[model samples]
Target: MLSTALAAPAAAAAPRYQRYVALGDSYAAVGTLTKVRSAPIGCARATDNYPSGVAARLAPATFVDISCGGAETPDLTTPQEVPLGVNPAQFSALTPDTDLVTVSIGGNDVGFGEIVRKCAELSFGDPFGAPCRAHYTAGGTDVLAARIAELAPKITAVVDGITARSPNATVVVVGYLRILPPRWGCWPLVPFAIGDVAYFDGVQRSLNATIGGRAEAAGARFVNPGLTTGHDVCQLPGKKWVEGLVPTSLSMPVHPNARGQAHVAGLVAAALSQ
Candidate 1:
């Protein structure tokens, strides 16, 4: 009777998720959207970000999001300048008692930003036959693949480092959301060379796989957003969760919109419940 009276509650049967720490790059920053955390310059963080949303839903816990725009794996491993703010890097915010950690990185490492810039640059003159799209569609660029492979070990190291710090924490690695669909629908605004959209998706997918594999190897759960495939940005408004090449509002083109962030928050929340 004494043991039964002292037994842990059902909610405490499994490790109760309490402290939440988020780490990653621009895509996860939730900047440029309303309620996002702002810095004096560079990429700003957002309170409406998925982590923020999840934190609100899972109240009564500490929430710390260290995500920034243009963040890289080395940013977590070493001390680097905070592009806009005073803080050094996102990892600096993490501690030994973190109950949860979410990460989505490596896109900037592959020069995805450059790709978008080039695409936008070329689209101005030749929307369809742009040299940037041409080079990418040629199927010879191993840059993205090579970059992701190199990052795999670094990401795994971060996971090990985190676990070393918080022996009882649950590390969650979030994958990239789909940018383009298997098929391109809109022209001009989202025009790309034949099959280029799929190619881009494949690269993003490969990069995400590397992140997931490494996270799993380090004993973390991998949360992939690819499950929202058909609902990628290219879809008609009200149907798409992620935004396409062009944003509906005056915001960053490639990053997630508020709706998208909400979806991500739900996913993260579900993972924590498990």
Candidate 2:
């Protein structure tokens, strides 16, 4: 009886993760400020991305990261072409033995890069008003909101696909960090007009909520970095996790910097511990 009880606690406490596979897009793979790693050159997969941090911290027996720049949900099932190389269908890394999976995607599906660029361009036209918001909300439609609603099911499909492929894995969906604050502040640095700042912020919040909802509904866990605000683009280099239109950090404009990746990894690690 003593042996059985002691072994039960030890077995229950044993590490469940061994083979770790990471899937997602730029946010998941590209720590724009960090040096490129073993992934394809075009992937721009950074050595310091959240997955790298997590792997280093957890010291998994095996690790595979197939994340890439500008990836979408379809990219998870189908190969994606990057600037100078092609990232294989992300799901190819999974197996029945895989025990850890992280997903950080869906921004590209909504044309997030283009939206930020457009909002910046529109801000130049009317930096005092909400020209960007007006442009997107034209014809009595909130275009960004519609895109998110349309994308909810597709995001859920990704969860289903991941679970089907890696049945034993503990899936963690890391939500995007904040970009702009809930109110307007930065002007020339980011170029978003006074009203457009909050407008885009709302769009991002909705997207994060969808990602979390899908992950939880599909029996996966979600970690929301957005909950800790003040790391948005408007903040200075040290304070901001995300860069602005003209990046102050080595990261790409509007993407997460090295600090941001570290923060995300910490959040994911905490979630895993729990």
Candidate 3:
């Protein structure tokens, strides 16, 4: 009886999952040059993306990462057009047997890239003031925040879809890392206007909060990209997890570098183990 009872507990303590699938946008794809070129060319799956790190650490029997650049929530269910190919629906990877799913999406859905472009363009004319914030909040309403609210439901739907398709899966939603300092950081280095730095920083935090809440509400766990506060683009090459406009490291402008990917990988793995 003792041996039989011990077996039950021991089996239960084994790895919680054998099959794992990762879904997300560019932020989740952050890392160095390609080591695993399994994803499409434009999908930009780095050799050291957090998903790969998680998979390696967990040693799952099977793992799939379909994260792509420029992907939105809708792309989770539909194909996304890349430069020379099409990334199949991320949901296609999920099956009844899938027991772990991680997602880090929603920035593009909220028009973040456009906002950054517009903000950068506006900064040239008013480098000393909050031109980007003024432009976004021009009509007495914050359009960026409004967009986040409108797209919030789609994120919830993504979690729901994952649950319905992979009922046994542990869905974990990962939030974006902080790209800027809390206050007005080194402006020209990052290209954000002096006064608009804090404003845009707040916007990022708000987006993370919205996604984290929606994911939790939709029955998935949340993992904030914590411990990245001081590692934003403004920092030097060796210290920064994200690179600035003129990258001093091997990462796209304003994207996470190798160190960032590795750090967040540890964070995700820790979250899963807990």
Candidate 4:
């Protein structure tokens, strides 16, 4: 009788994650990081993106990836109209049967691209001064910081909506990789004015903190890529996870490369296992 009871317990296995849906923006889609051989143009959904890596390791029964470049918080519910194609609402992929969902968004909504572009443009003239910082912080206001604060609620709403759609799914909100070094940045490689480098880094950190807090508040697990230590873009070739202003690989400047995506996948996998 004792043997029978023990065997029964052993025979009953833990449930596996059968369905997974990946949703988010350029970072999540791995835009310009690698080629999207099969995805529609402008979607930039790379085959080797973090989502794909996670799906491979988990080996889920169903995997749906709806991430696209330039997606904003609204794009999660509204169809995103791309230049050459239109992507369906990202949340449409989520169902009650979904066992897992992962998202990496909000950078576009907060104007990260514009900030980078403006910084790069200004850096050409003032390579040693904090020109980018001065531009955004003009009139005694940090516009980018204010934008991140405003987007916090939107992030929470997106998580809540995901939960409403897939009550039983384990949702993971992934944060961005570090792009700058701690003390100084690679001026020649990134071209951000010497003083503006730290300013940009601070902005990225604040954004990640906001994202992490919102994910926690909405009952979703947050996976920080933890790339701040030695994986910044300024690191040596093999050690760097993010690409510089002029990328060495196919990845876009200031975004994660293939190595960064793989590392983020590993972090997500670890979170799931726990």
Clashes of each: 4, 0, 0, 0
Model 2: residue 28 alpha-carbon error in angstroms = 0.8
* Candidate 2 residue pairs in clash (backbone atoms < 3 Å): none
Q: Which scores higher on lDDT, 1 or 2?
A: 2
* Tens digit of per-residue lDDT, candidate 4, span 1-274: 4687766656644347889999999788873444784445677788888999999898888989999888999999999988688989999999999989999999998998898889889988988899999999999999999999999999999999999999999999998888787646777567788999889988888999999999998999999874457888788777888888777778877777888899889999998899
The reply for model 1, stretches above 4 Å from the true place, is 1-15, 39-41, 79-84, 120-141
TM-score of every candidate relative to the true structure? 0.83, 0.93, 0.92, 0.91
Model 4 C-alpha RMSD vs. true structure (Å) is 3.2
lDDT of 1: 0.73
TM-score of 1: 0.83
| Better model by lDDT: candidate 1 vs candidate 4 | 4
> lDDT tens digits, residues 211-236, model 1?
88888988999888865677676777
Q: How do the candidates rank by TM-score, highest first? A: 2, 3, 4, 1
- On residues 1-274, what C-alpha lDDT tens digit does candidate 3 reach at each position? 5687766654435555789999999888757754535458788888688898888899788889889878999899999998778999999999999999999999999987888789889888998999999998987999988998987898899999999999999999998888889887786767789888899888998898999899999999998883358999888879988878788876777788888888888898898778
Q: Highest lDDT: which candidate? A: 2
lDDT per residue as tens, model 2, 1-274: 4687766655434355789999998898878645986547788789888999898888888989999988989999999988767899999999999999999988998889999889889888899899988998999999989999888888788888988988888999888999888987689888889988888888989999998998899888999988778999889779999888778888888888889999999999999999
Prediction 2 TM-score vs. true? 0.93
Scored against the true structure, residue 192 in model 4 reaches a CA lDDT of 83
Off by over 4 Å in 4: 1-15, 31-34
